[model samples]
Target: MSTTVLHARTLPGDAEQRWPARLWGVLAVLCLVVFLDGLDGSMISIALPSVGHDLGMGTASLQWIVNGYYLGYGGLLLLGGRAADMLGRRRVFLIALGVFAAASLLSSVAASGSLLIATRFVKGVAAAFTAPASLSLLTTTFPEGAQRNGALSVFSLFGALGYSLGLVLGGVLDGFGWRYVFLMPVPLALLALVVGWKLISRDRRPRPGRRDHADRGRRRVR
Candidate 1:
């Protein structure tokens, strides 16, 4: 007697079918958010001379202005990722974006160099939350397939573009005023917030019944 071998076949889930449109929109918003993040990261560097001259910042204070933001951003990244997993990525992303925008506005209006630096620190904290949430949202939303690969590629390209564009935009805005350099992200961030809220699905915890059903289905398939 000849035995036939059966190859295991994996089926696409409901999320794979329903989430593509929403996922695309979310991807666009995330790209923009990351772009703004990259822009802000470099913009300050280009505008530092003007900022120091205008605010009459000494050398030590100038170093702190940049160092503070870096320290804050690095310190909060892991915590932010955990928060996104616990609180839900979309919720955290929106909240972070809002915080970032508010901080940017504060930096724009700050009266002293110290105040502006403080706002930059706050912005860095907000970015820590935004960056991880944005990426996590994309990963969770898309399933493993050509689609997911394409989405990630696009996301990476946007990040790189943002980094490069930051220098150019910084030069243009810095020519106007150092304040413009800080204020530039506000509108884009607002737009990203609006798009993200509209496009990203709320992260729901898996219900017990759903988990049980999945387990039962797997057993039956076996």
Candidate 2:
């Protein structure tokens, strides 16, 4: 049997019919990361009572498990953006994905509310980096206008659908243990890490513009 092969759209800039196979793979990985991020928050919401029961959490502190994640995620948004710029988007994304996976593993086995909350915070922090980096990477990889718009639509659809699916998944996994909710994302993260590593292109950064020139000019004048 002969199999037909489809070529990928050129990595950003070519308005073409067949997209690069690697581009689709990269999009899947990026969308998976976002999907898991959205799912983690929603899925855990359904498991809170179970978590509280197992961890012996008080009402006051139980809220923090969720809030802790938000705190780390929201607070670090700016820092994560800067990190993607300075640290390199692909490198930062991979590191953050690892952090998210590790934190999920830690969260699954946490013996105390303190530990669980801390792990959630860590996951959220990782998410902060992953979100922007994924978006930046996606846009750059796809061409402007229709191509980028289509990619964004797919990315956002995953995010929206993840929340919906998470609730159902949370209920199903509840039979196993609330820990499964946190534990589940770990595999997805790992898979994304692998796919991303293989498919993500090594991008050359554009040079800094007027800021560098101005500084050099002043230094030379002095």
Candidate 3:
């Protein structure tokens, strides 16, 4: 009789690993970055009066300043998502954050209304890439079922909090200078980039064989 040792295979969902504490830290960093994006988006709106005064922008130009950023952001979202999927999410997220920080810096240093508006358009494009990629990364990192639900809930809560905080912070920063609102995200984005690079490892799972093939077939049918 031959004796054989058999090891049990754990299913993806059946793995008994608990949520690591580092995951929370990563999540918090992601939240802060997302919050900054939200804050920056609204900060200009609240500070428009001050901005117009400083830059001598008229009403029509002011409207263009705001509208241009939105148009750029919304128009590029689909492209951003596809890019995130094609490139690595982590790589794209960091690149977007870098672009966003650069744009914020430019906005802060802008001497004219047109310069500021142009910077805002760049920032919006950067955000289009960063936001969805960050969320998709979080979803992919966290295990599914209860843990994933909890993580998503926390992410959503931070998003809501960021929006409310932005409104309050915008008012306060407006009193100081309109530039500070734009400058604020620079440090936060930097911090997030650092933490994300240090703590998050690339996903190393081998692509599922049959499922992947089936998915490709479905896509072809579509």
What's the distance in Å from true for residue 115, model 2?
A: 0.5
Q: Please, what is the whole-model Cα lDDT of each candidate in the order they appear?
A: 0.86, 0.90, 0.82
Q: How does each model score on TM-score?
A: 0.83, 0.88, 0.82
Quality of model 3 by C-alpha lDDT: 0.82
Per-residue C-alpha lDDT of model 1 across residues 109-209, encoded as one tens digit per residue: 88898898899999999999998998898888777886778788988898888889888998999999999999989998999999888878878985679
Model 3 C-alpha lDDT per residue in residues 103-133, reported as the tens digit of each score? 9899888999889889889988998898888
Expressed as tens digits, the lDDT of each residue in 1-222 for candidate 2 is 123223333433355645788989999999999999888878888888898898888888888888988899899988998998888999999999999999999999999999999999999999999999999899889989787899999999999988899899999898899988889999989999999999998757879799999999999999
Model 2, backbone clash pairs (residues 3+ apart or across chains), number: 4
Model 1, CA-based lDDT: 0.86
Instruction: Give residue 33's lDDT in candidate 1 (0 to 100).
Output: 90
Most accurate candidate by lDDT: 2
- Highest TM-score among the candidates is held by which one? 2
Higher-scoring candidate on TM-score, 1 or 2: 2
Cα lDDT, model 2, residue 189: 95
